[model samples]
Target: MQEATADTFIVRIGAVSAGTIAEDGEYPGLWGAWDQDGQFMGRHASREGVAAFLASCFIVDEQDWS
Candidate 1:
């Protein structure tokens, strides 16, 4: 396991659920949601544009998981 810094940012986007994008200590990329059983549930893009899109749509107070 690894640790995250305050500068690290994670972006999530979806209709029903959200997933992580560019988590701390992990390689820069997109991620998707998983079921309670840890099975993948959906898809998300990891492109630079996708990351920017996620950031643009993000709302801190509504989605803050910190």
Candidate 2:
């Protein structure tokens, strides 16, 4: 058996929305997340998912987004 080790990574949040209004007068928005190296992690339907994924990982730099 091998011992478990944690790998550290930096995460960043991005907007997956097109930022355009639809003909129905509705705007679409989504929470997109990625790693420090600009690697695609996953697409989330809600901002909570993005935050959850980031929290699940061993993040090194928790940059101030707010």
Best candidate according to TM-score? 2
lDDT of 1: 0.38
Tell me the tens digit of each residue's lDDT in model 1 across 7-62.
33333444422323332233335444333244433435543443444444444425
lDDT of each: 0.38, 0.39
TM-score of 2: 0.39
Instruction: Candidate 1: list runs displaced more than 4 Å.
Output: 1-19, 22-46, 59-66
Q: Write the per-residue lDDT of candidate 2 for residues 36-62, one digit (tens) a residue.
A: 455545555565565566545424344
lDDT of 2 at 17: 22
What clash pairs does model 1 have? none
TM-score of each: 0.25, 0.39
